[model samples]
Structure formats: structure tokens, C-alpha cells
Target chain A: MLTYPKTELNKVKRGTKRAVYDVEQINHILDAGFIGFIGCNYNGKTITLPMAYGRIDNKVYLHGSLKNRMLLALIAAKEASMTVMHLDGLVLARSGLHHSVNYRSATLFASVRKVEDPEEKKTALKCVVDHMIPDRWETLRPMNTKELNATLVLEMEIQSASAKIRDEGVVDEKSDLELPIWAGIVPLKQVAKLPVRDALLPKQLKTPKHVVTYYKKNKT
Target chain B: MLTYPKTELNKVKRGTKRAVYDVEQINHILDAGFIGFIGCNYNGKTITLPMAYGRIDNKVYLHGSLKNRMLLALIAAKEASMTVMHLDGLVLARSGLHHSVNYRSATLFASVRKVEDPEEKKTALKCVVDHMIPDRWETLRPMNTKELNATLVLEMEIQSASAKIRDEGVVDEKSDLELPIWAGIVPLKQVAKLPVRDALLPKQLKTPKHVVTYYKKNKT
Candidate 1:
């Protein structure tokens, strides 16, 4: 299995047991979610913002308006990091100190650059939209020249990455196990409800096959 | 309504219509979620990590092992920022450019300091645990002196804050309305399953009232 080299930047310090450096595992964590918290330095303080992203191989794509401050800062700095997490469950323990959460999280450090080539930019945009919902870009209206010009696309070539996963039952002190308090795991899931069609659409138009498939796979 | 003053640090530049500065609205966004993405500078590169947080008025609390590198970085910086977001739905549009998510998100810039007072430290820790689930701290075994001392608690006093909310339906270009593509919202929700009791717990001990209440409120 391919794994990232543990550097000072991507090493997990506090929870060494939960730390993961394998590339496949980190990619799995990233592919499970579409939104990522992107960190950038702004006015001497680091700030994070959520953005939709897509991954192909070792590169992640991000797009926004040309005037986006955070994206501009990233390009100026030439390096960036994004983190994604999925909360699986809540771990309740007999003691307050032992309480924890079941989660899988990944952080990627990458070099940032603008996607200037038109064809590459278009492919990146499609990758991003398709990442949100598989086969979504095929049915959508194609981007016009004006729209394409106004958009800013960024390419992040991942340099180093790490992941952490905790998927276990409660762990409490030996003495606290016999306490009268209840303890267990409460599993959490992000599910989808029935789709609501836009009022502008014709009543006769039906939901597409991809939409139905996504709903079936994601619904509670 | 009380609103945070517009400043360069917390200003929302792109989506002016979705920007919210009202204190009550921002607090509502903060209270709806427990995990926040905290940004910190590491070796000249900004990194974001998910951390459980609790908010009391304008102050946010975070705790971890005393040796946590991220916590120590925040203390060294003396100022930090956190971003919390709740994804509400997937907004599929006829044009890929219009595709977006219905969400409520808040970002806070704060001055950070380590909590040294014993009483305040205990209170902050309780707040952090209780924020995960209401009334959880009261039922769990209290923390011992060793545990308390081994923990590092940081209090972030909010200096500026801003929120963005988008709860409306699909907004597509007028020309794309005639297209046959599917357009609408797929509502997303984070829900809890039935609690699983720890194997060590006596079969006689029942799930607590707070856990049941939390489940009832969050279940699909």
C-alpha cells in the first residue's frame, strides 16, 4: 500500500494510535465527502471556509468567483490545506473524560495553482459537479463563454496527507465500568429526503435516472 | 437586532445577499452544531482540523490533551478563528454554474487565551461536554484532579463574527428554464440511530433520559 511520508506538517501528534498515513485510506476519507474546510492566511490570522471540491488522482479542484478573497489568498501563498470529516457516531462513556466521537477525517497539504487552460478547466468543473452527484454534469446546460470567463478554478496538487479514524465502542476507566450510568454508541448518518422539483420546471418533466439512483442510495 | 460591526476580517465579500451579521442569527448557527473547523498556522502553511466546541455568549471553548500541537499553536498565536457549517440540502440547477447547497454557516475571529482558574476550567469543560448533548455533563462521573490538570482548555473571546444562510429554492437563468434537465432540492439531514448499550454495562441499566431525548429530537 502506498503511504505518505510522515513530515512535520501532516503528522498527527495527540492521537498517535488513530493517525493514518496510507494514501488509499486518506483518499477513501476524502472521497466519502464533497465539502472541505480550506484554510488560508488572511491579515496575519489563519481562517477556514467550506468549499465544494473534487478529486482525480492526487489533485483536488476548487472553483469560485474571480473575486473570492480566500481563493486569491491561496494562489498568492502558493500552498494550502483542506480538511474533510464525516461524523459517524457519538461515543458515550461512563466518565465525562472518556466521552468521544466516532469519526473519519483527512487533511491534505498541497501546492496551489490556477487552472488557465480552457479544456482542463472545463474538465475540472465537470469533475466537481459530478463529484456532488454522479453523472450530473451530462444533463446540465453547458457553460457559456461569459460564465466560463467569470469563474476561477484552482488546482491543488496534494503533497502530503494524513487521516484519522475512530470507529469503536466506548472505552472507560476500569472502575467506572460498573457505575450505574448508561454508555454506548449512537450511530449518526447523513441521509436524503424526497426531492422537491423546481416550480419553474414543467409538471410533465420527470426526475432523471441519476437523481432517482442518488435518492435511493442516500435516503434513510 | 444586535449586529457585529462590518470589518475587513469578518466581511463576506462574494455573496452579499447571503451575508448575515446579526448576533442572534450567528448564535443560532453556532448553537445548531457542535463540531467546528479550527484554523491554525503550521510551518508557514495554514491547516484546518475538526474540533468539538462549545459556545457561551461570545466565548467559545475548546479542550484537548495538554500536549496537543494545535492547541499550543493557538495559544502561541494569541488569536484564532473557527468555522462551523450545517449542510441543509443539495440544490441541483439546470446549469452547473448555479448548483449550490442550502446551508447555514458561521465564522468567528477571536482572541485566544488558556483558562487557568480552576473553577473556570471546570465550568468550561462541563460546557464542552454538555454542548455535545444537553445535560450530559451532570450525569457523568466528575473529572478528577489528575484528569483536569492533564487537560488544556482554551477560551476564545469573539472579536468579530459573520454568518451566511441560504434556505431558498433553485434560482436558474430564465433561458435554462425551458431545458429538460432536472432541477430541485435534495434535503439532507444528519440523524441518529437507536442507541447501543456498552457490553460492559449491566443489562438492567436503561438508556438515560437525556440520551433518549436527544435521539427523539434527531432521529429521522
Candidate 2:
């Protein structure tokens, strides 16, 4: 076993590419992401949507109008699979044949239940807010009864899951290495700029330092 | 009734937030993502994983080692639902109550299936390569039979879907306008850096500008 056995996905034989299995590495990838692509089937059509979500203690918490048909169907099905991702960079191989992407991603398989409990729902909301900005939940107003009733929270109990990744760059076959082609990685990054408050906000309101530091993410 | 009716979800009522409805816009969001988050249920233990994927026309293509249990489950399910996402930026509101994120996201319903045809799988790979780097596909070498066989191709048909977004900063109720708060949108972006070739790649290889100038996605 390697020093990082938990992070390896395929241990048997990786005929082509090696998969990452480290949970720490995976968590790093998740925190770096701001959104996730939601995939599911309805009336026989496969539809994909990008949505906002949060990760807490290994489980995923998502909220939208309870009326979201896709969320309804998946929760109704009681079972769904979601793919969350962080695109690290683009892989450039010597030959177009070997071209690929350098990224870190994950897939979750779990049973979902619509969160109905008032306290649990509040906890879930706090998880999301804290995920967006660490410890921001305590600094903001707690969910009033009205706001809680207005939204539906769904909890996906993550069961069996796996993460696959293609990092580094093209490893041309021994003979193909001689080909004259640029081969390497083109990095990708997500950056958050300075906070912009709402136009209608009270005149006395000012930006918080955490809000400013929360935006430390930027392209290198 | 609103100028941006498509932005609102259909299930939302008059008092709810305004959401976009154009499915085409939703598809555009799908194309913008580099990775995905998968939620699934297996053996009752819920788990989530991130993955790399490509959007070609109305289909989403995701591949990995066929031996992967999670992917096998998707093919086995034949039809399931998932969410694909790209987070554009964070929206900072003046009032903590009105705080929200500025994001472009889409949610979809889909039936998952494994791509069987060899030519089709090859094409999917090409599409994936192109999706990640645009025109760079035409510049690369063709995939040989072995490379094609090593990868597992799963295709999801993009049928009925919805794209929703909140692009601006804080939207406080009219009365909240008098509150003194800094409010505006903090822009977010996905950027690419100069390409780096592999250490062993031929020295004659030169970087192509197209590899660097493809469409930039706004991801979380």
C-alpha cells in the first residue's frame, strides 16, 4: 500500500490513468468549489442543472423551493447520485490523441429525505452559511420562523461514494514521447472579488472584514 | 409578468424570489462546468464524489474506469437524476438577512446509460476533449483502439431542464433601503494560465493559442 492508500480509487490495475483516493484531497477539492451540477431523470429525459449546495460532516445539505421538480423526483425516488467537481487545470498531451483534462471530482450515492424538523433545518442552514463563510452563521441573524417555513431542506445521507481525478499531464507512450507537440497542464482557478452590498441596504451598513477576507480566492 | 420570467422556478409563487426558466440557458450552464458532484445511495450509507465531464449538444458525457462501482450503479439504474453546477460569483448584501450569492446554476432530470458503440465512445472522448479546450481537439492526435477500450463512457440525454440565476447583489425589501449597509456583487471567474508541457515531451512541441483561449466557465 502507498503512503496515501485512502486517496487511491483504483488499486488493482490502472490500465490508463490513476485515480486519487485521499479523503483529505477530496475535501480540499470540495471546499474550493462554489457550485455543483445536479443530474437526474424526469419523464424519461436526462436533465442537468447547476445548483448551490454545502458539505457538512460528510453529508450534503441542499435547499431550493420545495417545489423544485428535480429535487422532488430525486427525493421521491429516495435514491439519487450526484457529481460534484473542481476543475483544476487542462491537460495538454504531445498528441491530440493523448489530450485530457486535469481535474478533481466526486460522485455521491445516497438516500435523501426531505428535512421537516425545525431544528434540523436550522442546523442545515447554518451548515450552508458557515460553509460559504466560516463562522458567519453566529454573526448573522438566526433563521426566523417565517424564513424557515419558506424553504425546504433536503438531506442526502451519503452512502457509498468514490472520487476520480486526472491530475499532472499527458504521459505519452514510450514511442509517442518523441512526437513534436506541447504537452503539459494549463491551470484553472476560481477567484472571488471584493464584496458588493445590496443597493437597498441601510445607509449605516458597512462591509465586514470576514466578508473581505472570504474573497481571498483569486487566479494565480 | 416579469421581464426575466425564465429566471424564476415554475414551482415558486408570486412572493418567492424571481428565477429564470430558459432550458437553453440551463444547457449553457452545463457546458460551463468542468466537474460534477454525484449523490447516491448504496448499502444505506450515503456518499458523494466529484467527477470530470463534458457537454456535447444536449448530452452529458462522463467516463472513468468501468470497474468503478458508482458508475456501474448509474448504468445499472439506467435512469436517474443528477445536478451539474458552475458557480459564477458571490453576492454580498448589506443586511445580513438579505445576504445571498450571485450565481448561475441549472438542475436537470436525466436517464443514465453506458455508451456501447466504439465509434460513439471515441466521438464522446473527442467531444470531451473539445469541451474542455474547444478547437484544440482538431489539433491533437486521434485515439487508438486501446485507449478507447480503457475508458468507460456514460451518456446522459439532456431533455427537460431549468436554468436559474441570481446575478446581482443584495435585494432588500424597499423599506430596508434606508439601512446603512455595504451591498454589491463580488465577481467570480474561472481562468486559465499559460500551458506547460510534460518534462519528457519532445522539445520541438509548441503551444497552440487555441488551447489557451477557449470559453471560460464560471465554476464553484
Candidate 3:
């Protein structure tokens, strides 16, 4: 399907004008960032924490220690929801009420399941690592049996998702626009600095091309 | 108190070495960003959304439309938890198991209350704006009664909070350090770009000092 069939749960209620339901668009928002806020119920209170994730088609992968509380709770519940957001700019407005931020935000409701097969687990871990920095996972030393066994990998099948994007300049009251107050957008972005070699690295070992490429791509 | 007393709810479980309970350090993490991931129960599922927030002492101010579902849900529940995270870098390790990211993340649990007093509501709104761009709130046109009434302001009194900070280079197994693989840290940061003036702005008005200062501080 080109778009996700929105249920009451995934519908955007407040700013419907900015909402998007297209599967491709939602995926684009998800691919823009590797970190997402995954919500879990803890001690009768819902808490969200940032987690690194990898997406392959409609599936997202998350990994943590086998005893991680949030992952265990999500596995027990058999369902999860994750949200990813990118703050594009500050929408400085002429009036206090109109001040907003230009951002792209997507939330996904999914069916969560633990990956048991060793082969599938390996692929999932690679996906998660490559999602953060492309092409770097293959360069790392392979995971041994003990390391793989200690980690828990979860696969979330995206059931339904929606995204909201606001990428424009200020939207202020017409009357207030004529005021002498300055108004505009200050664009914001996440960037990478030069690579800092590990202190114990052999002096002859040079930085990898993949690391340099990532720096060049994300550097401001 | 110098530190928040750890409870079953706010204690860090997995990364004890990186966990921070000191109140000053938690506040520092909170002040580093203006957005937070707020978790709420919706349709029997917990969901998280990124929201802009302002902090003053122990209270966090969040403002949205009166009909916003998340805000209303928070008011009804009278409890809330918010998390803020800053991704510092990608820690590229020689081993897959040791690969991690350098970051500062904080989670806060608080009792939620709706701000009904007009003066307090105004103060809350101001706090949210100033938190985004210092000194810009007073420069904007004042909020009218209609705008104030349409907005819902919430005050969350932080009862407990914890921060985890991992800001270091790669840590690989001693056995893998001698391997010929490349390992290091690729530092990452969120930065501000040059401000774009509103399209309809009169050419005479220059960019405000507050915006300029913000850009100077945040720009790479």
C-alpha cells in the first residue's frame, strides 16, 4: 500500500493539516535519523528513552542487554511504539502565540517480537550498526558467541505509522506581521566533527574511508 | 538535596558507571536542550512525542493547544515522565560488541499539574519561549487574552530524575586492541546555521542580537 491505513490510534488530531500518512513519506522521516524514542510502561508510569535503531523495509531493529527493563517490558507486552523527530529550524514569529519550530516527526505503532534465530540476529545487529554509520559495520570484528548470546534483539513490524512535517517560514497573525519585531528561522542540524583516533591506536593505522565519508556527509 | 534519592522508578539499571544522580548534573543535561520526549498512555498503548519545554528551578513548563491529546492526557493522569538526550559521537570499536555512542541522556519523573492562574500561565509561556531563544520572548508582541485562553500550560514538579553520560573514546576488549582494525570516535553535535529572515520582513530590520548570539554559540 502506498499509505498506512490510519486507525484512531495513529491519527493526528491537533494539527491535521501538517499530518502525512503515506508509507514512503513516513519511511523517509524514519530514515533521516537512527535514534528513536521508544515508550515503555514502567512502574505504572510510561517512560520514553532514546534508542538506536535500524530499519529494513517495514521492520525496525533494537538491541540491548538481555535484562534491559524497557526491552523486556516491550517483549512481554508484544507491542511497541517509537517516535523519531528532526528539528529543522526555529519558527520565530511576530507574536508569542505563533512561535513554533519547523520539524519532521514520525511515530510508528508496531508488533514487537524477539528474534531467536542466530542468522536473523546477526543481520539485525548489522542493520542497527550500519543504520548509525553506513558501511562501518562490516569493518568491525565479528561478534563471538558469548557477545551475541548476551544481547537481546527485537524486531518491530510496523503496523501503522504517521508523520507530520513543518518546513516553512513564520506563520503569524496578519496584524502582527507589520510590527517592528524581527522574525525568521534559525536552521538547525546535527553535524559531525573530525574523527578522534582511539588513544591506544597504532600510529600507522589510518582513519577508514567510511568514517571520513560519514564526517563529510554530516559535517556542517 | 545534592542528589536525587534513587527510587525503584528513577534508578539506573544497566549502566551504573555512566549513571548520574547529582541534581546539578541532571539540570545541566536538561538545560542543554529545549525539546523532550514525553511519554503518555494512549489507547492502551504508551506512545512518545517530542515536545518543546522550558525549565525553572524544579518545574518544567509545557504549552500546547487546549485540545491537544497528549497535554489533556497528562493533565488527567497527573503524572508525567520526560527524557532529553544529546548524541555526542559514534564510538567505533574494534569489536562489534563494544561499539557504542557517546551521549548525555536524562529522564525525569514528575507530578503534573495544570496552570490555571493567569499570571503563572504567562510566566510559563515566557519560560518556554526564552528556553528556545533567550531574550526573544520580550521582543515579541504580547499575548492577548484569546491566545492565553486557547493555550494549555502544564507545570511538572520534578520529583526524581537521573542522567547518564558517556563521553569517551572507544573501549574494546584487550584482546582486540592488538588487531589491525581501525577504532576511534567520530564526534557529533547539533549546530545552528545562518538565520533566514522571514520572507515578508521589511529590509530595514536587522537580525536581532539574541538570534545572532544563539547562532554564534551553537554554530560549528
Q: What is the DockQ score of candidate 2, to 2 decimals?
A: 0.40
Error of 2 at A147 (Å): 1.7
The lDDT per prediction is: 0.93, 0.62, 0.93
- Give the per-residue lDDT digits (tens) of candidate 1, residues A89-208: 999998878989999999999999999988889899999998888999999999988889989999999999999999999999998987899899999999999999999889899999
TM-score of each: 0.99, 0.74, 0.99
TM-score of 1: 0.99
DockQ of candidate 1?
A: 0.90
Assess each model's interface with DockQ, reporting 2 decimals per model.
Answer: 0.90, 0.40, 0.89
Residue B214 of model 3 has an lDDT of 97
lDDT tens readout by residue for model 3, B110-152: 9999999989999999999999999989898999999999999
C-alpha lDDT of residue B87 in model 1: 95
**Candidate 2, residue A59: lDDT:** 73
- Chain A of candidate 1: what's the TM-score? 0.98
RMSD of 1: 0.8
